[model samples]
Target: MGATRSHRIPRRAAHPALAAAIAAAALALTTACDPVGGLNSAAVAVTTDQVATAALQHQHVDIKWLTCTAHLDNGPRATPSAGSATKDVADVTCDGETKDGRPITVRGTVTQEVEGRCVKGDLTAKVADRTVFRASVLGDCTAPAPTTTRVTPAPGGHPTVTVTVTVTQSFQGK
Candidate 1:
């Protein structure tokens, strides 16, 4: 009788280093390939409109605008230290009753700046006189730097090419 031999299958060991690199690459690729969501653009623009309309209809309109900023002195490897920011918000609450107790209020917000540079978009509103209310302002100032990729020239006499890209939003808001 002939002897039969069984073949064994070989399994490859998982490399954590390779896995991490792949994950990072995937994250970068997804970010770079993704487009800015329209919903967010709508949100930024909508905030302005909400304030504008509220000011016009409400008796007392309180207008608030906040400005925030984030600075990074280090690359991805190190944590960044945040600096104190100046207030860019303006609060204007229109009370229908003034010193004489008349009725009228105008609430609104204007585009602001961070450390002196204009940041958030424009906003404005007005309400009937004699109305009373409070206002609030809020903002964030974290701007993400664009990611770049360098390409090497094939074998020909080609120069290196650098591409500017952003995978995900550096900042977000409600």
Candidate 2:
């Protein structure tokens, strides 16, 4: 019989690290796909949609549109249903920081639409004569059509590639 020596696995195995990295990457991809839940390279959940949701809710619509046409600062805005009333676009603002310590702010209304009380199938979320929300604005107010927008955060020190979200929204009573 030959003498046998005890063997033990290494405390830090490359396999485990690799697995964790892969899992993190996979999660990042998933969150990145959504308007919110962005990883921001450092697992930072920061974005326009997230900010808007925090500031407002039950008033979100997948509002998507193009802005600053010449500069192409495309934005997002959701379509509201007919006879639906939008909660007044809150003249609210929020402050937050990215994963990299970069401060960001969302200066807009929380986009959304809801249907319930339809007095002659007409509703509006106008402020000071500004058509921020309206029932049947799209001509069809039977179904709720979510919207989207694109927003890119300011620079984060290094040359980091920015992901522009096409829209930001939050809905209530639906």
In every candidate, how many clashes are there? 17, 30
Per-residue C-alpha lDDT of model 1 across residues 69-124, encoded as one tens digit per residue:
11111213322354433322332222222223333333443334221112253222
Question: Judged by lDDT, which candidate is best?
Answer: 1
**What tens-digit string does per-residue lDDT give for candidate 2 at 12-38?**
222545433443343343232222311
Q: Mark the 10 consecutive residues where model 2 has the least summed lDDT.
A: 65-74
- Model 2's TM-score against the true structure: 0.19
Q: Each candidate: what lDDT?
A: 0.27, 0.26
Q: Report the error of model 1 at residue 38, Å.
A: 20
User: Against the true structure, whose TM-score is highest?
Assistant: 1
TM-score of model 1 relative to the true fold?
0.20
Model 1: residue 160 alpha-carbon error in angstroms: 35
